[model samples]
Target: MINQTGKFIVIEGLEGAGKSSAIALVNDLIEQHTGQAPVCTREPGGTPLAEKIRDLVKIADASDPLSDEAECLLIYAARTQLISNVIKPALAKGQWVLGDRHNLSSLAYQGGGRGLMPLVKAVSDACLAGFTPDLTLYLDIDPKLGLTRAKSRGQLDRIEQQAIDFFERARQTYLQLAQQDDSIIVIDASQSLELVHQAIRSQLLHRLPLLFANK
Candidate 1:
């Protein structure tokens, strides 16, 4: 059922998998196809308040451990604001929503990478409350290469600076979810940008034909 609302698409990947760029490309493609600019935004900063929370969470020197549970809650908090302020309103107005990151990040980062699998269900169940993406693009990449690219970009955030093992687990977990979930499409971001964009466009066209079709 096309529930009288717009579809929500989330772009997910490790730090340097080009999620931001892919999101911009996807947003543009959606607009070009649908003739309406989707509500494009990122997590932990979609809303002004949430952006503050993001800064705190990303601070490497913060005394707080930012426990997996806390991290999950903080992400949910940002998501709540994002849903209320951006997502729901856009969907109600029949505008597509393209999010750069979503709960999947916490799932892979905390549950898989940080070895907090047990906390996954609790936080996800209580916090998410059935709000799931219609489609998730997981840009898969090697952690070593991804981190190197990330380093070149600039200084790393707390999570961005995590050890190679951490990101390896994160990437693995994302791939695992892609295997298990039909909604997730895994793309090899190790390829060149042009190839990656082509793959993503193809996948989006195949999965969201209605959105891309003649209106």
Candidate 2:
């Protein structure tokens, strides 16, 4: 049976961290064990308005550059829209919520990478209040390797196009935050896909036993 309180699980990582595959694994596991599919959502998206904001945040224009503060606000704006319209509503109905790159993405990219922690923190405080994920799986990988993988996919977006040093800083921040938060589990994303998937499954099963009570 579904639990009385819905759980929010977020997958966080830098570019090319295999978040899509991780999300798929989590969703499949939840359905297999709980017999209920989670409501999947992605940051800077999952809503019409949020999607438009995503476009604005991604499309690069060298001549008309976006300031760090502006970028930070845009991200939070998109997040607020998604949370208010989709995430919260789905959870209220006792449905699990699976997120691909939530608040942590902003903390890593905009705050750590772009050096806008104060602005990001202010926006997060004002917008999200104390909202947090029940379980966060952070995929850790070397910035260079991750960037190479991302490049193989296609042209990098504005954020993805950042320098390797930027991503390294982001990775460090992710690691630090993971250590501080017991709910955040760090996974070695450099491993083989199967191994990574297995690790994710193991962590989920360990952290959220209630979801797999029937299994």
Question: Which pairs in model 2 have colliding backbones?
Answer: none
Shift in Å, residue 66, candidate 2: 1.1
Q: Best-fitting candidate, measured by TM-score? A: 2
Report the alpha-carbon TM-score of model 2 versus the true structure: 0.95
Sliding window of 10 residues with minimal summed lDDT for model 2: 206-215
Query: Can you tell me which runs of candidate 2 are displaced by over 4 Å?
Result: 210-215
lDDT of 1 at 133: 85
lDDT of each: 0.83, 0.88
lDDT (10s digit) by residue, model 1, range 88-165: 889778788999888888789888998887787677788778888888999999998888889999999888877889
Which stretches in model 1 have alpha-carbon errors above 4 Å?
1-4, 62-65, 210-215
How many times do residue backbones clash in model 2?
A: 0
Candidate 2 C-alpha lDDT tens digits along 1-215: 44556788899998888998999999998777657898999988889999999998999988999888888899899999999999999889878899998898888888899898888888999999999988899999999989889999999998898888999989999999899998899999999999999999898878777543422
